[model samples]
Target: MDEAESAARRLAWGVHNAVGFVFTLFWTAGWISLALLVLLATRRRDVALRMAARCWAPGLTGGAGARLVVEGADAVDWSRPYLLVSNHQSVIDICALFQAVPVPLHFLLKQEMAKVPFVGWYARACGMLFIERDNPRAGPRLRREAAALLGAGHTLCLFPEGTRSRTGVVAPFKGGGFQSAIDAGVDVLPVAIDGAGDVLPPEGFRVRAGVITVRFGAPLATGDASGAAGRQALADAAHASVLALLRRSA
Candidate 1:
């Protein structure tokens, strides 16, 4: 293409993204408010989760002109609770997961997220767990709470990398989620998400249209495993599964 045409296309893309970003803000706020009211009135987490998984998440992605392509979602037994460990690449990964995963999933977030404005309020109301990573007492507390949540039949999603990968590469996994799975006697499920980085890169506010793929792997059992050694083993296995899925998706 000529220089003039190329420049025009770039400007158009930027304008499109800016408009989408504004629309996303309003869309998210409206849905979160509706979900919050449902939670308050019914005190049923399933109601809120259904609204998010079936409505808000998909709405945000669709409004941004993004499509969700999921594979192996049937591999997940929605009837049972499992700890979902996934590789994180972008903020939009959360939306993709919620849209693709059939089960009601709660996130394991940093305790500080509980203080954010709309997000914090909605997260707390949805029964999401937050942990103070730096506080020494937080470890045992998190495990205890996680076990209880699992026992209560909620599927908790954890990004074992702890943060988004700027390079779109899967980072090293942390053992905390695996430990919690072992404590709760629940299986650990590995999910791989791709293409979200192209939609919204780390620290970028604008959302570019793209397709995001979410692939689920077989569940890794943390059977009869306990303590540091068991946690490390489970983490390694789950990481390997996720990395393999990433390769396949590529």
Candidate 2:
């Protein structure tokens, strides 16, 4: 691209971002309150999940001028529970997955997220799972919580890299979420998300309009994984599957 075109793109991104920031703050708060209300009134998670998958999530990505295209989600049996593991890029991955996947995701979040004001409150109110990654003693409790959530047929999402990838490259998967998957005895569904970081990079809110593709891979069974060694193996397999999905989509 020429210098003129490059400068024009930057100018467009800046103008759109100014509007997007305001829209995000209000749109998110409104949907969150409504989701909480729906959960409270209906006493059912599927209702909230439907709203997110159909409306709120789509609104977030679409509002950013991102065209989201999903594939392979239809192959999975949504009736059964899953550990929806995916590659992390930026916060945009959350909205993309929530819309791409046909279910509500109870993310296996960091325990610190439990303190993020309204977000934390909504997560707690909705019974989302939070892992204390820094606390060694939290294992048994976490395992029990994972089992309960999975047993209740909740699909939990986890970014096994544990944090966003600033370089837009998939990092090595961490073992904690894999251990939880094994303990819970649910299948690990590998999801690949491409191009989200370009839309909203890890550094800050500077945005771009782009296409984000979310592709799902076959679920990896966790029944055979037994010890710590087995957990590492599962994480490795999940990571490889995600990489393969990215390659396929690319």
Candidate 3:
């Protein structure tokens, strides 16, 4: 088989197994599994995140293929709290992000997603914060919660573009997430994910397997920079870093 056909088959097989596992967990494990996840979340957030990943590990392996690679992660201080910003692609981006950063991550998600069945429950239990896209109070609430999370020494992962791009191109970055960093007083780590859009294109449920690389750029310097200059700097750095990674991969 050629590259494309091999990729499609691998992707389908992986996703199929993953759905089966989720169903098994729902029936066999039942509430016990959900309880265990909650207990784990309370006792050890890192382990909880790891377990979350394990629940879909088979699909993750198949979806990413052997070409999935991570680069430049050693430079991060896993013990300390830092803002992780990345380019948004497909739903697969969540799994890739979690695996790339082996730390307890709190994602800034949309309020609408909080209504999903298992996923919504998991996100809430994991202490993931969600913002109402159209709510005027959203900004203030996000800043407040972000400050609290950072104060409590928890790391956050947010997509600066706010939403997934319809096209493969990285969308323009918004400054609000960076503003949260200023409020929380932490450095922002820019992450770039290559080929996720192609792997699971946004257009449909069909999957195409290939190399999905997660690249980490050096932490964007926040230092004394704040307000517009700082936000712009962070946004520019994130876009440039991801774009550069894509170019390198190509």
Local distance difference test, per candidate?
0.87, 0.85, 0.74
The most accurate candidate by lDDT is 1
lDDT of candidate 3 over 85-113, digit per residue (tens): 88988777887877777776789999987
Q: Rank by lDDT, descending?
A: 1, 2, 3
> Which pairs in model 2 have colliding backbones?
none
State the lDDT of candidate 1 residue by residue for 81-191, as single tens digits.
999999998888889989887878899988888997778999998889998888977788888888899878889999999889989888889887677788778899999
lDDT of 1 at 85: 92
lDDT winner, 2 or 3: 2
Q: Whose TM-score is higher: candidate 1's or candidate 3's?
A: 1
lDDT of 3 at 104: 69
Candidate 2 global TM-score:
0.91
**How does model 3 score by TM-score?**
0.82
Return model 3's CA RMSD, one decimal: 4.7
Candidate 2 Cα misplacement greater than 4 A, ranges: 1-12
Error of 2 at 245 (Å): 0.8
